[model samples]
Target: MSNNLALNIEKIKKEKSGIDVLADIYFHAVFGEKISPENLERFKWYGIYAQDEQQNYFSIKIPLNMGELNLIQLKTLSLISKQFSDDSLIFSNEQKIEFKNIKIFDLPKIFKLLQEVNLNTFFEAGHTVRRVLTCPVNGIDKTQLIDVEPLANKLNETFIGNKKFENLPNKLQIAISGYEEGCDVQFTPDVSFNAIKDSKEKILFNVKILGNSIGFISPSQVLKTAIAIANIYKDFGERDDVEKSSFEYLVKNLGLIRFYDILNSTINYKIQQSSFKNEISHPRKPRLGINESKIEGQSYIGCKIYDRVVQSSKLDNLSSLLEKYEANRVKLTHKGNIIILDVPTLNAQNLACELEKISFNPFV
Candidate 1:
């Protein structure tokens, strides 16, 4: 493990991409083989981590794309938690679901279960793109300037197993928002795309890297711009010090202009220098309680998971209500609240009461 890469983790990533560890993981999980120290670190790539010093128990984190799940997916997660994870599901602020205290031999079964639901832990913890975050009400928010969910989904899909982004100096996080007031403006991620209107009254995305607004891009250019920035960070980001390895640190050291120049070379279009109207400077209101959706006769119910833990039993109970109300999708907000989407306006109150019965405070 000797190389020019300063951090041991960097060297490991250089030697072997974390995505290639699946076979080894399968073997270890099925045969109960002992994991070597290097592989233990590599396990982070799959969102698997040793839960104890002895490595007898493990924890797994499942990234929810845009924090979204259909009713069937939610039911499957509940079944997994109830049968295997001590009847608990820990919802993270990063909008991931975690199951803790799992025995080693159960890993195979858990992974299989997740696969059935089209979920994976790849890059969930390692020096790769973490789960892409987005506005919870992207498609349904009344005040949204554009629906960034499709772009977010496409951006996430483009990078998931792409080798160019596999071995970065540090983990990367990206958030996309179309909220008129800019939902992710205050949050810090390696990159963010906030929807805004141009002087010509056309919609464009205000691109920020490490909390600084680098420029603007048309919706059609977001994917390419993101790829270019990712490449810049992969090639030039500082690796000598773990503390300085994040893309944020690199942006600060290189300054925006130099970074923008590097970015321009990697993409087809010239980057546009622009400023965003800081709407967040005014008082911000939280999206809570039953609210009207963009679609007529439809409503969305937002409930505060205040403590952010949902028992498996509650999800089991919720499955019935989901079917009863014909609400098929649930969204987890960046603030840790949960929103049940696509509820009929007529059924919103009854559904809210049902959510309250399970300790999901819809009043919030």
Candidate 2:
């Protein structure tokens, strides 16, 4: 097959940006109008997917900003699941939330519920950058060297729904972590940033392409570097084969040297060559059970979620417990465990015991 030929998906994207399909969504979901097949495919941009050939049921994905949710946000999600879904939520490896078995008519209502908590489904799927992943314990982990939570949140905010990135050749996954040792990491994203200290003891990011270190970049250049990468991908990525159109595939085909050259030229800046002496230590045991947070006299509970499924009733119970314990927030880990953060040391044991009773099971 000729790689020069454009695929139908590319053609579909050219016809309209996926992010502009909200009106069609309202027409179909609110007015009960029949959806065209193209519009059905376009719904993915907003994280809505048909569950059956009849297109009567859907599953929606909600990407969390660094997967951190406050008490009210968590409770709102629980209430939405109880009201609109089949009483369950599926947490993905990317730290996004999913609701299954939703009727077509209930999607807008669910989205409205999400809006109350300042969450949105836009750019949650489609051919743009997916959720920007980061260390679950970004600011809270005792081992963190540099707090990447603010940087990650800024990156996520800058890209999602941006008109320029709406129609990429394929989806991109990016992960950043401030963990000094990169411990217990489950997977490598298309682009990754691992915190490193230079010989001068200054914090910098060791950037990698598809798991191989490309070079180092300063904290300020992260957003610009990401934009350059996306621009290069949009311009030169293969569009003939949907299955082979990933940014990783493009990098592999072009070879690192050529891809790095293009990235360097596109960004119009010098990237430190991959000659740094920083080493990425191999991952260790996952952060399971209760652990001390970065703050003295405060702790977090790491509750292992089996199969990434949680009943809404259990989530409601978890939310109530957060209020009772006055925990600061909840973070969904890339490993699919739920970490209840910022509980006082005095209340940690009681909170862990209550969480275990609901099958959150911190002992595992």
Candidate 3:
């Protein structure tokens, strides 16, 4: 695909840009309201990607921060799948919920539905800072001293919908975790932070900027540190070659020292010594089958669907099944799996069976 995006994306905030035109399409579909060719390419802002095989249909991606979804949101998403798309909800490696074969006409309704249920596809895709991923067991993990959810949410709330950060030179993938055992340090596209403690047990974060050397900052500083780096990326990232415009490229071109100088001007970003290290060496652990929750008598079920594809027809059934068993909270994993949280231990087997009935194989 050619990179004509920089010119077109600027219109996203204007009247008829992809996202801005959604309301018009929603209201005028009966009168043949159609997206212009220019807006067609801009639809990714709303997580709507044009299907390669079908021009009129799209594939939708939903952002679930920290891989979480309540019972209501699941019902809304699954129902949209059954009503619109091919009943195929694809689980992305980043833990997002996706539905393919969605009609161009249905984008508005879907967006509206998600808003009603307190869920959204906004900023899930495109050149924006994608979904904020965090430790799945953030609150429940006994080994975790601090909950990364607050910090992750703070970063998300700071950037999403804010015009300064809305249009980035490239997408930024951020991951935060309090647990060092299974963290997403290596794969995060832009930046990552692992919550840690010094010898005095004071909370701080080990920061990885543009995937380079380690740095340190207080728990309250992740927001400022992130903004500074992102601004540097915005001001200097390679926009001409689209392909070379990644954070990695910026780091390679300017070198870490220059990047640090630019970053220091934005916040009191602390650069740790060469010997400082973070302990998160392994990948994120799978929260599958039946795992003990922090609360006794309740467990989180990690069920694997053959691959990440959850058919539209199965979603409604699965949603109902989860609600029936009183396990309404679901979390998607980086491994492309789903975890049913807060299930009663006694109903774990029954829930697993129901999931299998819908072809979401729990045994795997």
lDDT of 3 by residue, 1-364 (tens): 2256555454543444344645654554445455555565556666767675336667788877788988888777778877887666778878788888777667777878988988877776656776667876677656676877778889889877566776677777777778544365226446777777889999777777644445678888888878887788888887767678788888879876677677777775455534333343665676567777777888888888676777756777877887788887888777777778788988989988888777776776
- The C-alpha stretches of model 2 lying farther than 4 A from their native spots are 1-7, 180-185, 275-281, 284-286
Ranking by lDDT: 2, 1, 3
1-364 per-residue lDDT for model 1 (tens digits): 5543235777677667787898888888778878877788888888999888788889999888888888888988998888788998888877788899888788888888888989878778777877677878878878888888789889988888677787888888887778534564236778878788877989988887765677888899999888877888888988768889988788879987888888888888877885533223331234789999998999998888866677887888888898999889988777777888899999999999988978888985
For residues 252-314, could you state the per-residue lDDT of candidate 2 as single tens digits?
889888988988887767889884233456753347688998899899888888867788888
How far residue 122's Cα lies from its native spot in candidate 2, in Å, is 1.0
Better of 1 and 3 by TM-score: 1
Q: Report every candidate's CA lDDT.
A: 0.80, 0.81, 0.71
Q: Which of the numbered candidates is closest to the native, going by highest lDDT?
A: 2
Cα misplacement distance, residue 124 of candidate 1 (Å): 0.7
Q: What's model 1's TM-score? A: 0.93
lDDT of 1 at 214: 71
Between which residue pairs do clashes occur in model 2?
A: none
**Which parts of model 3 are misplaced by more than 4 Å?**
1-34, 52-54, 181-186, 269-280
Q: How well does each candidate superpose onto the true structure, as a TM-score?
A: 0.93, 0.93, 0.87
